[model samples]
Target: MKKFIPYILILIALGIFAGYYMYNKPHAETQGAKADITINPADLLAAFELDETKANAMYLDKIIEVKGKVKSINEVEQGGSISLDTGNEISSVICEFEHAASIDGVKVGDEVIIKGFCSGKLMDVILVRCSL
Candidate 1:
């Protein structure tokens, strides 16, 4: 039993190391990557409104390029969020940029195309790691 103790301890240490490595792994670069889907923001919002679960299964973790008019902008710690009007009064596609300064030229009512990963949806469909 004493001889097996060291082996067990080594195994435990290795398991911990493996978990930490995976947990800290850097995310892949989404910038400059070709979008998997290009669609109007209004259409995208409609899909989510119709079927959120299905929309998430199809779009989540996938890069999408959306074109729309900016409705609002809000700065955050990580960067900022741009709400794009989706031809709807209630919902919009919210694109979260990594750096607020990166969206310097963007403003309300500007027509722009942005690409990002479709993370999920709340009151709005959420896109993260957005870039022009």
Candidate 2:
């Protein structure tokens, strides 16, 4: 049993290092990055509405670029979010940014293209870590 002590210690140390590395890992840069899937806001919403399971398998965690008129703009403590009109008052594509300043000049009714990672559908389709 004593002979395994050193091995156990090494394993613990390796685990700690791995955890720290993963915790501090940088987020993927979305600016100027090519999107994995590009779709219109309404089309995206329709796809999710039609088949949530299939949409989740295709869009979740993948970079998505959508072009639409901004339906609303919102600011949060950490960043900002904008909702793109999806032709449905009840649902829209919400894009989130890490920097509040990212939405500084943006306004509702403005047409813009946003790129982000598709998170999932929750009434609205959510896109995180977005960029213009």
Candidate 3:
């Protein structure tokens, strides 16, 4: 027990340092980062709708560039989000920006390309850390 005391202390110190480092890790910048996959909103929705598991395997956690007409913009307490038309009537691709400035100049009916990290679908396919 005496011999192990120093090793245990060192392990505890390393654990604390690792926790602090993880807590302070910066978010990934999507604005200038290249996308892993690029697909239109309609097709992207269709893929998920047809086979959610396969879609999840392919798109989940990947940076995706989606091109479609802007359906709507929503401002919430956290930040602003944009819904892209998917022709599904009930579902759309929801792109979430960390700040409003990321979505500036975008409007409904405008054909645009947006990039984000896929977080899987609820009613709508959600993308986080989006950029124009």
lDDT of candidate 2 over 1-132, digit per residue (tens)? 999999999999999999999999988977989999999999999999999999999999999999999999976778999999999989999999999988899988999999999999999999999999
* lDDT of candidate 3 over 10-129, digit per residue (tens): 999999999999999999877899999999999898999999999999999999999999999987678789999998789999999989877788889999899999999999999999
Measured on C-alpha atoms, candidate 1 has an lDDT of 0.91
Query: Where is model 1 more than 4 Å wrong at Cα?
Result: 1-25
- TM-score between candidate 3 and the true structure: 0.82
In model 3, residue pairs whose N, Cα or C atoms come closer than 3 Å (at least 3 residues apart or on different chains), thus clashing, are: none
Stretches off by above 4 angstroms in model 3 are 1-21
Candidates in order, TM-scores: namely 0.79, 0.82, 0.82
Per-residue lDDT of candidate 1, residues 3-103 (tens digit): 99999999999999999999999876568899999999998999998998999899999999999999999868788889999878888999999888879
Clashes of 1: 0
Q: Looking at model 2, which ten-residue stretch has the lowest summed lDDT?
A: 72-81
Better candidate by TM-score, 1 or 3? 3
- Could you tell me how far off, in angstroms, the CA of residue 74 lies in candidate 1 after the best superposition? 1.2
Ranking by lDDT: 2, 3, 1
RMSD of 2: 3.3
